[model samples]
Target: MTTHNTAEMRICDAIWSIGVMLDYTQKIAGFVTPELLDWRPEFPAGDFAFSLGEQLMHITDIRMWIVSQLGTEKHAYERWAGPYPGIDQPWTFRAGSHSEVMEALESSRQLVQPWIERPMGELSLPTAGTVAAWEKALAAMREKGEDTSQLEAKGAGTLGSALFFLLAHENGHRTVTQTMLRMAGAPVERLA
Candidate 1:
């Protein structure tokens, strides 16, 4: 029997985490009916207490947000085309129906699929030409004396951390969703 190196083990763990998240997503999707989509706890906490549909949509929203940051060419904010629930604005994408919400969830999965499929060995290495392109852009910004603070604040952009972020983020949403379902009286069974 062969033992894997630390990097290989880490990647395998990340893959396992992703699989667990997928299972949670599918289980939640299975029990959420169309009527329950708009259900929310009567005790309100403003937007913090999102409806069942928003809670589900938020899972996809945040998933895409994190995945978009992993790209070499564009930032997450730059690539965000859907409703952005910024400080003042509200999210506009309606979880119109059960099927629509599922479709959005599918789109989110697709965004992260490439990273999941990447070889563990290749993930540690920079993509060919990507580093050069990034350097060139950074050099131009520095030469122009432009502020790079926003650019710097984007997380490490490493595959490991990004995968971890996806898992952690989805886990939070999963908890919220399950709680929301329970409050709405449609709680799904916990995975065995």
Candidate 2:
């Protein structure tokens, strides 16, 4: 049987510690215009690509996925399969108006709060079926030259890696969204 590690919780706490995600979500609200929310940064084809809008969608979907994956209760492999809702749904994501995306993003961030607070040090990540998913997330960070040594050291098959990946996934997009907004000459001021 696997055990939740107190050390792992400390690491994750620093990642999304109390009020950190809440502050993030609140600050992001009303910071960008509906048009600016639709903005995308200039990047090579397939290179860290995501418009501000797409980033928001990706954040929302991934937040839910991480919460599901990292929940204290273990679930069947089959229960995890299927196309995630709101993913790539431009009508509700990219093409949707700014308010739509903001609403979804805010709700998703809120959904992630309890999971972030829950202790996950003891729970182990499912090794076989889901290892590839987190491996991809870690690979994305590595491609950007981020020091994933600690995360990599976890061997890509533990809850430790999974928690860190979620933090990376959500935090990466949030940072990118802000940068993209700035690049468009929008104020970086906290709006909420």
Candidate 3:
């Protein structure tokens, strides 16, 4: 009989969490509008300098970061540029239209889905710098008699933690966007 390890279970849980978040985000995106993007809600005034569209881009950026970390290959971090500080800044992208934002989210999911579905054995633990650096770290850890099994456990912990952070970060932005919609006198329950 084939048995699953703790690491494999954690990876599966992470994938499931991300799937739920993606569905939620996709639904929220349907309610967003160019005008809603422009409105700045006053309840929490002078908080964010960027527009709603920019915040959505930031959410995508965070998602891409998680995606890049799932693999060990070079060019794993590559993603389409958005209107943020740089390609890395998913928060500042200028998504002027609802269609554009939806497309961007869809594109991000497409890039991430394969990685999410990949087996835990095929996925690499987070390593520092280049592959050479990672190898050196592994050697050092081994010399210190660090429990490699525990290291796998720690990595499993990371998968769930990363998913939680990603979901929370996206939901924070979604709250702001929904607030803006309410301020614009548009129905907000449709998003929830």
Winning model by TM-score = 1
Model 3 agreement with the true structure over 54-152: per-residue lDDT tens digits: 556666677777655544554433343344465343233433466666676677767666655645654354423234444556678899988676554
Task: Write candidate 1's Cα lDDT for 1-192 as tens digits.
Answer: 967664554444545667667667757766778888777777554553667777777777777766655665443332222555687565565426678777777777767776776667655554433344456667788899997776555423466666677788788888888877877778566764
What local lDDT does model 1 show for residue 95? 28
TM-scores, one per candidate: 0.70, 0.55, 0.58
Worst-scoring 10-residue span by lDDT in model 1: 72-81
Per-candidate alpha-carbon RMSD to the true structure:
4.7, 10.4, 7.2
| Candidate 1 global CA lDDT score | 0.66
Give the poorly placed runs of model 2, Cα more than 4 Å off: 1-22, 42-49, 72-94, 120-159, 189-192
Clashing pairs in 3: 54-91, 57-90, 58-90, 58-91, 83-92, 83-93
Indicate whether candidate 1 or candidate 3 has the larger TM-score.
1
**Prediction 3 TM-score vs. true:** 0.58
Candidate 2: tens digits of C-alpha lDDT, residues 24-71: 744764566776765766666534445666777666667666656555
Better of 2 and 3 by lDDT: 2
Backbone clash count, each prediction separately: 0, 6, 6
**Distance from true position, residue 70, model 1, in Å?**
2.4
Q: By descending TM-score, how would the candidates be arranged?
A: 1, 3, 2
Minimum summed lDDT over a 10-residue window in model 3 is located at 87-96
Error of 1 at 102 (Å): 0.7
